[model samples]
Structure formats: structure tokens, C-alpha cells
Target: MDFQTDKASLKIIRNKKLEYELPFLWIRDNCSCNDCRIQETKEKRFMLNSIPADLKPKKISINEDALNVIWPDEHETIIRFQDLELLKKSRKPEKILWTNDFIPNNYDWSDFLTDDCVAIDAFSEFIAKGAICISNSPCILNSLEDLAPRLGPIREVLFERIHNVSVDGHIYNIAHTSLEVPPHNDFASYSWPPSVQALHMLENECDGGKSMIVDGYKVLSDLKNDHPEFFKILTTFSVPFREFDEENETFANEPIIRLNSSNEIIGLRYSNQLMQMIDPSKKNLDTFYKAYHELCKRVNDKKYKSTFRLEAGNILLVSAHRVLHGREEFKPSGKRHLQDAYYELDNIENNLVLYKELRGN
Candidate 1:
């Protein structure tokens, strides 16, 4: 490899067609020398403010595996070429969108909780598809806590840590009623709601109430393809949402669609039932409603929903940020109880990486 440098950056040429341009400031800021970093933790010690704005390398040396740079002050910095290549790669799995006919991958509950290989497979599928169902889970009430060893800690929210949904339980929300619940993620009222949810069915002797899920990201993609304007509006327009009981209350005003720095969709905060009334006098109210209408149509379309039934020992895990879960109306004749708890997707994804490393993958 050969390299050339200018005032702002260094250009490393691996071949006639392959090359990389790295900024000089970035390299200097990331100097891995003992003086620039803590020896024990390898945490950065040199602050960017301590350096000059246009600092350049006084000398540069390239070896087969690394690049060596000498600053004006004779401080040396070494960076591995392999590390630079690794920086361009990511471990996060690409999302695999699904349609109405999609069926969630099922895993045995015992294998999922105890085996690393099975956990890795299940977690990877969950990350890709945004949902998975585990069969033969413990049927006892409050058994959702047993998932802590695999799903990390339960995220406590208003009213309860683990929620019970039943016609006979606390009627704080529509989930307790026999009426049909539209596709939505829970706790959309929170600014940053939990990203992961596990609905553990303890009893389901009801005639109907088939579980339904919509890939909110898939709907957004379709909407973006059909009406980019509507997609843009939903991402930028903040809407009010709220959920409350007799004593507890929670509320937030956030965009229905969330994006990351790269303008990639990262979340969908959609809760139709919990959405509060907005003032008619607000700016762009008419335009926002039009966009919302288009979004709503696609979200509830039968072409986007996957329907199934939850048995007594089934646990449906959902990535709340990207998937919307709901239930069809059922008769109140027979008993039907489900317990749900919240967790963060980060921990579950990290656990997958750890398991992979342990298996020498």
C-alpha cells in the first residue's frame, strides 16, 4: 500500500482502484499512544481542545500492518490497517421485512433459555424480523420474570412492572376490554419507550382474540415508496399521546416515526388508542392529518398484518420500536390472561454477540 497526505487528510491506496481517505484530525484525536490514552482502561486521555485546529503529521511511515505518524511535537501514533477495515463493518443484522402471510419463527422455550447456540439463532431471527414466539413457556402467572436470564432486566413503567391483560383485570386501557385493539406499540406516551416487549400467555381459553402484528417499518417503507411526502411529515411532526389510570398518568408529544443520524428509520411510536386530541389551530394541522390518514391506512391494511393465536404456554417477543401488536375482539365467556414485561433491545443484541464470541464465531 502507498499513501499521500495533504493539509486536511491522508489518502491510503491499497490498490489501483481501492483507497481510503482518513482525516488528520480524526487520526490525531484517536491516537492510541500511552500519553494520549489511559494505560489500564485504554480510555482517551488527550482532549481534542488541547490540540491545534489544523494539526498535521510531521512525518509518516507505513508498514505492512500499520501506519506510523510523528506529530510536530515528536509524539508518535500508530494505527492498524486491519482496525480501519473493521471500522467500516457492522455487526447489526439487516432487517428482514415481512407481509401478512409471514409467520414468526418458533423456538422451544427451554432451548431458548438454556442453550447459547439456540439463543443466538432466536436472537438473530428476532432482530431481523422484529418478532418471534417461544413455545412451551411456563404457564404460571408472573412467570415472565423467568425470562430475565435471557432478556435482561424488566423495565418498570407506570402502574406496574409486569402488566396483566385480562377482562377481569385492571381496566386502565383497551387491552383489558373484549373489543378489538388496533395495531400499536405500548407506552407511546413515554419519550423513549421500551424497545422490547414479551407477552407471556398464562391462560387463553377464549374463542377469538387472535394475536395480530404489523411490521410498522415495512408499512413505512411502502408509504415512503408511494408517498414520500407523507413519510417525511410523519417523521417530523410531533403528536400527542397519553395513557392513564385513576391515579397514574403519563404523556408525551413525539413524532410517530423516528430516525437516526443517517436518516434511517429506527422507531415507530404509533398508538392510536393512546393518542390524545390535538388542537385544530396548530400549524400544518390539515396537512399532518392527510399524511396521518395515509399512514393509518397502510398500518391497518390486511396486507400488512400477520395473525395467529397465543396458547397458554406461548410467549410472543416483539421489538416494540419496529413492530405493532394488537388483538382481535373476543367473547368474554372463557378466561384469557396474558402478562407482559418490557426490556431493551440493546441488551438482547449484545447477548447475541457475546454468545457468538463464546462459540468462536
Candidate 2:
């Protein structure tokens, strides 16, 4: 089998091996109908988890420069070779999937939070890699009025949307309601992965509730080193998750963790409350549970912990997948507030590039 790229189309010369290796499910998923477009806003067009797997393609044909696929439900799509190549480039290799191999270790984060947003030399290096923790005085959120001067240009490059939340906002209520969030990675349940999370603390007065982060890469490495079989079971199984909202009648189900073709750990979906019980018959259930508990113990350990109280004006950013974050239980009477925003990894990279161009860094 041979695959080639050309303008506006892709050509795949089919052979026996191609038929044997390519799954119809893959073709259905890579569908580019208006319904499947990420940019579409219609409710019914939203992708559903209930799509049947056994439904076969109605027809598959190869043109001079493209592969055309028609689904049984009458959704027809075309894949251009150039577009396929572009997708291939954007996809990270399995081994380096969750790792921040691109971020420089020595990148600085001093100017990440400021009243008059100024791009620092190390910003690009930080975003390219995965995440960065910016240390600064005075709250990033409190000075939002003056944010444009410093962070304005970077915002244009990096953020698809930016806005502030009042104290009465639901997110604010959630943050305030729970001082102790169970061990979980951020946004691991979403099929469309969430790449970056920025949390800039505006106030902290509670007694406890210090931030906690565990390096998932390090945890998985340790598991592979000591108990490869247990790690294998974990990577192989999918733990179900459920999020219920009575007010909106919304619910979502997703796996707790996901692995790529090579069985490498590509995602962490660790919400304690959201997870349903695992199937009992799977091999290594007891051993896997033991290893997982031990991993959690290590993550919660004081020695592995990096403790900090978000003072009045400090901002912290982290790669949601790489870092599992939570806070210690705090006193009920004290006050704690933090402002947060979400951005894609590509957006952050864009900001870094713009900053470099402007600063000549």
C-alpha cells in the first residue's frame, strides 16, 4: 500500500495489507461532514458517544488525488493527502505524547503576570514545552484593567476567548465550595483534549488548602519500573466516568485514562467522584489497585509535594495532563479566591512566537 499527498487531496493506493490493517471505525471517525466540524454550533451536530461501531461504510473510492468515503448514514467526505500530512505533523508521537519535551527547563516565568503585560524572553520556551509556573507579586486578576498593556498582545496570539468571572459565578462557587478536591487530572475525560490551564490566584486567607501537584509522567515511570504488569492492566482498561448536573440535566461518561496504539499513557482521567467501579474480571485488579493507591500516596506525600499559598496577587499555570492538582482542606471560615482561564496548547505557542518576534528574544 502507498499513501501520497497532493494539493487539496490525498491518494491511497490500496493493497491487501491496507484492507487488513485499516478499520472502518477509523474512517468513520475521521469524517469531515458539517456535523463533525469542531466549529459547528448546532446541538444535534455534536458528536455522540452512542455512534454504532459495527456500522460499515457504504462505499470507499479513490480518485486521482483523494480518498472519498461514504458512510451508511449517507455522510460523504473527502480526505486530501496534504490535509492528511498536516494532521500527521500535528499528531505527537506516542512515546512523547504526554511529555513536555519541547519546553525548555531553564525558561523564566517572572513576567507572566503583570499589570502592564510584557512578553518575557522565556515565554515561548515555556509554552512549547507544556506548562510554566509564573511567580509575581500583586494579583493578575485584580489588575485586569491594566492587563492589556502587558498581556494584551500575548492574549491576541494565545487565547480563543478571555473573560472574567464575578464572585457569584458558578465556577467561583465550585472553587469555594470544595476545599479538598480528590486526586484527578484536568479535562482528561473530554474526547477533544484540553491542552493548557492557567490559574492566577487573587486571594488566599484560609488556613489550609495549599496547592498540590503530582507529575503523572513520574508516576507512570515508577509503575513501569516496579510493576510493569500492573501498569499494563491500568493502561489497558478504561474506567468509566459520570458527571451529573441536576439543574441542566447534563451527564457525561468517559474513561478515566486512555492509551494510544502502543499502550503508552497518553491521558489521565482521575476524577474520584466521577469514576464508576471497574469491571471485576479484569486481570491484575488487586495488584493494579495496590499500585494505584501507592502512586496516590506518593503524590500526596509531603516530600514529593510543592506547597504554596496563593497570596493576594500570584499566578500559576500548569499542563493539565502532566500535573494532577488539588488543594488541602481549609478552614470553613476563611476566604480563598482564584481566577482561572483555559487555553489550547497551540494558542500558548502562538503567544510565545509573537512575544519572541516583538521582543527579539
The candidate that wins on lDDT is: 1
Clashing residue pairs in all predictions, respectively, total 0, 12
| lDDT assessment of candidate 2 | 0.53
- Which ranges in model 2 have alpha carbons more than 4 Å from their true place? 1-110, 113-131, 135-175, 248-265, 279-291, 350-361
CA lDDT of every candidate: 0.92, 0.53
lDDT of 2 by residue, 191-306 (tens): 44455555666767767777665556656666678877666666655555544343432123444345788876656656665556767996766876876676666556554444
| lDDT tens per residue, model 1, 1-361 | 8998888999887775447787898889989988999999999999999888999999998877998999999999999988988877778778999989998999999999889889999999999999999999889978888888998899889988999999997899999999999999999999999999999999999899999999999999888899999899889889999999889999999999999999889999999899999988888888899999998888899999999999999999999999999999999888899999999999999988888999999
